[model samples]
Target: MSASSRDRKFPLAIEALALSEAAAPFSLRLGQGEALSLLSEDAQSLSLFCDVLAGFASPTCGKIFIDGQDITSEPPEHRAIVLVSPRDPVFGHLDVAANIALALRAKGAAAQLIDATVKKTLALVGLDAQNGHRADLLTPEQAARLKLARALAGAPSVLVLDGLLNELDLRAASKTRDLVTRLQRALGLTLIHAASSREDALWLGGRIALLDRHALIQCADAATLMERPSDARSASLFGEANLLTGRVLEIEDDVARIHLACGGVVEAMADAELAVDALCILCIRPDRMTPLFGALAAGDDETPPLVATIQSVLHTGEHIRFRLRLADGGEIEMRRPLLQPMRGVTQGALLQLAWQASQAVAFPMKDDL
Candidate 1:
C-alpha cells in the first residue's frame, strides 16, 4: 500500500513537523500510538529535533499539528509533548517524590493531587522504592527512570526520548525499550525515540526514520528499509552492504539479471523497471551470501557462484568475519556465526560464495556518480 493509505489508517498524532538548523530542513509525520525511531549520529542535530518538538526551539518553516489541532505556535507547556533528554535536569536537594511532583506543582495542582500523582508516577516507573531518597543519590539508570516518571506526571500525549538508550548496555537497552513499548501501549502515547545507531533503532522495533545532514532520508520498517532502500545513503545506513555497479542484461518477471563490472553476473529482485544495458547498482547484505564448501552442491540452486581467496579473518565474539578478494580483484566481506563449523576455512583459502536473487536489491545508477 501507499504511504498515504497507511497514514490514513493510523491517524496523525504529529503532522508536518519541520525544523531548520545550519545544515538543512527536516520534516516528518508521526501516527497516533506509533513509535518512531529517528536515526541520526549527530548529537546536535538530534538535540535540535527534540527541542523543536518540545517547543524549546522554533522552526523557520512548516507546522506541527496534534490530534488535528495546530500546535505549531503553542508554548511547551501547552503542547502536551514531554521531552526526556539525556541532559534532563533534576533537583539535587529534593527527594524522588518531590522531583516527580515538580511539574504538577508548576501547573498549580493541589498539594493533595500532587502527592497522589507523584506516588502513582513513581510506582508506575518502578521507582517507588527510591521515593524518599535524594535525587543526587540515584544511579544513572534510576535517575533516567526518574526523569521519565517526571515527564509522565503530566500524562503528555506525545513522548520525545532523546538518546535515552544510547549509553545503555545491550541487556539494559533491551529492557528499557520493552518498558517504553509497554508504557506507550498502556498510556496510548505517541513515542518518538532518537537513536544514533542502526542497531539501536532496530532494537526499538517499529518504524525507523533515517536523518542525515539535517534531512529526513527514509522512513520505513526495518526489513523494508533494508530490502528496498531508496538510495545508496539509505542502503548504507543498515551497516555494511555488498554494493556492486552493474548493467541490466535482462528482466524476467520481478527479477533483473545484471552483469557486474567486477566480472560476475547476478540476479536481484527489482522493484522498478530498468532499460536493457542501463547501469545500476546491486546491493546485498554480507550475511545473506552463503559460502559453499567443496564442489557445487548437487541441488537445484541456480545462483551464479564466485570463488574468492580469504584475505583476513576477524573474530567478533559471537561471529567470525572474513574479508575475501575475488578473482577480478573485487573485495567483499562475509560474516558467519562462530559456532558454525568451518573445517578448511582460513586466510588464503579459496571459498565459493553465492546468494539467491530474491535476497538482493537493485537500484538504478545515479547521474551524479
Candidate 2:
C-alpha cells in the first residue's frame, strides 16, 4: 500500500524520508570517556558521511532517496546531505572559521564565499564573535554549536543531526533545538534529527520512526504515533502505558467493549464483529486515565469504571500520575492535575478509575502479527 504524503511533505516543499532498523541492540556504555574520545577523534575536520540516511549498520542495504529521486548509490556531498553527530565535528587546532571553511571546501565551494557563509551561519548559532578562537579552546556547547553552523554553512538540501542534543540539560537543549528548527524552516532545509527519546523528537516537530530488532516497524507523525501506534513495541517506545490483553464483552455506539484478564471491563472505539473470541490489547496513556474518586458521576454516567488502589503518586510538573493496582492484580495509571491539588485521594487511597470509551483502543495482542 502507498503511504500518504500527508507525512512526507512540509510547507517548504521539502520531502523527508525515514527508515527502520532490524535487530538493533541498545548500546550500554562501558566507559564514557573512551566513547567520547573515539567519536570526537574520528570527526576531526567536520568531514562526515553516511550512505544510508537512517539505518543500523546496513547503510548500503537501506534504500535512500532525496527530492523523490533514489540516491542510494550517490556520494554524500552530491546528495546535499550533511550530518552533525554527538562528537562535535570541529578541528581542535584550527579556528572556528577554518573549521567552517573545511566543510565548504569539501563541497568544492569558492574560498571567497566560504568566509561570508561561515560568518552568517555562525551568527545564526550565536557564535559569530568566536570565529577566531580555536575549536578546542571553546566550551562543549560552543563546539557543538560551531559544528552545527559548519554543517549549515554549506546550505545543504538536507541536514541530519544525531545525538548532539541528548547531552544538554532540558532548558539548553530545548532552546538550541528550537533555534535549529527555525533555521531549517528559514532555509527551506529538510531536517532528519535522530534521538533516543520521543521527547526530543516531539520538540523538533519531526515525525518518529521506531527501530526495534533491526526492523522498521512504525513511522508516523508525533500525534498519530502516540495515539494509534502500529504495535506494542512502538507503543512502549513512545512512552510506557497500560497495554492490557482482553476479550470483547460488549459493544456500544461504534465502540468495542473489552473485558481484561483481570475481570475489568472498558469500552474502546471499534468496528463491527469484534465480540466473540476476539483477543486484543487495549492501549491507554498514563496521563489520560483518572482515578475513580466516587460512584458514577452525573456527566459521564455511561463511562466504564475500573476499581483500583493508589500504588503511587508521581508529581510530573503539569500533572500528577496516580499509579493504581486494578481489581485483577494488574496495574493502571491515571493522571490528574491542571493546577490546584487533587482532592479526596491520598497516596495509598483506594478509588474507582474511570475513562471515556473513546480514549482506549483494542488491537491484536501479537508482537509481529
Candidate 3:
C-alpha cells in the first residue's frame, strides 16, 4: 500500500443481504475495495436504491451490512457511505475548495488537517488548479469532479454515485467515468456507481447489478450476465436480442427441440426445469447469427439453420446490421462486424443464418401454452 493509503482508513466491504424469496429481495455483496455498477432504466428507482444504501431512506424491511455489521438503521452520516448525485445541492457562497471542506468542517476537523486533505483530494480529482473557482463557474465535468472530491473529503467507506454521469454531456460523462474509475482503483475505494446504459456499466469494469421496475433483476460481471441472463427481459436489456415465442417439442439432455411460433423447428440449450410442451422464450443476439453465403444448412435432426428474407442491410461504419423477415412475417435484426463481407447479398435476398444451439437460449415463459 502507498503511504497515503496506509494513512487513510482501510477500504470497507458492504453486503446488501436478502433471502432468496419470491420477491427477489435485492441482495448484493461487494468485497473490500471492489467496484460495482448498478444499472437501471428508471432514474427514480436508482435514486431510491442508493438512498437506502446510503441511509437517506429506510428500507421497508431488510438488513444492510457494512463490513459484517448491520448498518441498516444507521443514519447517512453514521453509516460511513457517501452519496454523490447531480441533484445534490452546492454552496454558491463558497469557492471550490471551501465547498469541499463543508463535510470536513461539519465534523470539527482540525484546520491544518483539512487543508492538507483538501489539497490532496483536489489533486486526486484533477481540480487542484481550480481550487479558487466559484462553484457556478465550473464546467459540467469540473462540477462532477468537484462533487466527487467533496464526497471523498468525507472519507466515506463506500461511495454511491446516483445518475451523476447522466447529468453531463456524452463526451464529458465518458471522460468523467474514466477519471473516476482510475481514482477508485488507485485509492482502493469501494464504489457503487449507477449507470445509465450497458456501455457505461461495461466500460466502468465491475460487477453489474441490473434493476427493472424497482426490482433488482440480476447481478454478474458483464460477460457472464450477457451470456446467461436470468430472463428474457435481462437478455434484451444487455444487448439487442431477437425474442421468439416457442415450445419445447422434445428434450435430449441439456438441449431442447423447439417449435417456433414463427414457423421453424430448431434446438436450443435449456435448463433442467424445462420439459416437453413448455412455453419458452428464445433469445438470439444479432451478432451470434452467422450469414451463410454459400450452400445452405437448412435441415438436420439436430438444431437446423434459420431462414429469413433480407428486408434491408445497413452499414454503420463500425458494423453491419441486417433487418430480416421470418416466415410468419415477423422481423428480426442481425449484426455482424464490418470485417464480414456481404458477398453479393442484397436486399430481398434469402438470408440463411446458422448459430450454435448454446448461442440461443430458450427461457421458460410465464404465459401458459
Candidate 4:
C-alpha cells in the first residue's frame, strides 16, 4: 500500500511493512485525521519496540521476507532466528553451564543435545574455568557473557542482537564482538545488529542500514555508506561527517569545485548535481581528509599543498585522531598511527592537508525525512 512496500518487491536482504507502534488503548489510524494527536505518542513507543526487536514491529500487517523467502506467516520459533529481548532476565540461581542447558532445554532440546550445546557455547564464550561457578556468583561480565552463549547455543541462522552490547564495559564489549565475529564467520550466519553507537555498527563490517522514524532510509556497505550516505539522516548516522552547505560553481575532471556559504572554495568528485536554487550538503569523512605534507624539496613525492593547524589529538590505542582546522575555519579529523611523530604537530601550528583524489566521496544531502 505504501511506496516502500512496493519498492521492496524488487529484491532485498530483509523487508518490512509500514511498521508502526504506540501505547495501548491509543486508538490511532493513519487514514483518519482524528488520530493526529495520538500519532505522536504512539510513534515513539512503536519506534522503540521496533528498535528492541532489531527492526521488527509487533502485529505486522504486511508480509515479511528474508533471503527471498516469505516469513511473515511463520512464528518467531520457525524462523531459524534467536531474539533476545530487554525483558528476558538472566537466572540468578543457575551457574553458567546450567544457564546454557536451561535455555536449550526450554527450546525442547533433548538432555544429550542440551549438554553438547552448553559445552560448545561455554567454550565459545571463554568460560571453561567458570562453568562450575553459580550464575549469581559470577561477576556482571561473566553473567553477560553467559547470556550471549545461551543465545548462541542454538546455532540459529540469524542472530538478532539488540542493545546487549550497550550494557557491557569496553573490555567486555570488545570481547563479545570478537566472539560474535568468529561465530558469524564460522557458522556463516546473518547478523542483524542494532546499536545507537555508530562506532559499534561500523566495526561490525557488512551492510549499514539507517532507519528513520520506522522507515528504512539508506543501506550500503560499511565503507561506502560511511563515506557517502544517500541523505542527511544517513550522513549523520555514519559517524563523523562534515555537512557543508554549498553549490556547484565549476566541474572539472571527475571533480566539482564547490563554493561554501562561508566564502571558501572546496573541491570534491562530482557524483551528482543540483540546480542553482537546489541547496546541497557536502558530506565529507574526517578520516578521508588526511594532513598533507608540504612539497618535497627535491623530488619528494609525499608532500601535499593544503595547509592546516592541529587543534587537538585524541589518542586511541591503535590509532591517533588529529582534529585539524582548515585555513578556511572548517574542521576535519585525520587518523594516523599512535606511535607516529604527531607531537610536533601542535595546536595552532600549521600542517599540510593532502589526500588522493579517490579518497573523497560526495553525496546528495537533504533535510531530515
- Highest-TM-score candidate: 3
Please write out the lDDT profile of model 2 over residues 148-245, one tens digit for every residue.
Answer: 88888877656767767766777777778778777766666666666555565566554555555444456666687777777666666675557778
Better of 3 and 4 by lDDT: 3
Candidate 1 lDDT by residue in tens digits, 317-341 = 9788989888778898888888867
Candidate 2 wrongly placed segments (more than 4 Å): 1-51, 54-57, 60-62, 75-78, 226-236, 271-275, 294-305, 338-344
Quote each prediction's TM-score.
0.83, 0.76, 0.87, 0.67
Question: Each candidate: how many clashes?
Answer: 0, 10, 0, 7
TM-score: model 3 vs. ground truth: 0.87
* Residue-level lDDT tens digits of model 3 in 62-181: 677666666788888787889998668667678999999888988899999999989999999999889998998888889889999999998777899987776689899879988988
Give the poorly placed runs of model 3, Cα more than 4 Å off. 1-23, 292-305, 343-349, 367-369
What's the lDDT of the predicted structure labeled candidate 3?
Answer: 0.80
Q: How do the residues 1-369 of candidate 4 rate in per-residue lDDT, one tens digit apiece? A: 654454333222234454554211111111110001101112344334334233344544444444345555676656655665454557878777887888677778898888888888888878889988888787666776777788788775556665566567889888877877786666656566665656666666666556556555565666666666666556655646666666666666767666655444566666665433345566566666655443422322332245567788888888888877766787767787766675456666767654454555444545452
Model 3 lDDT at residue 32? 68
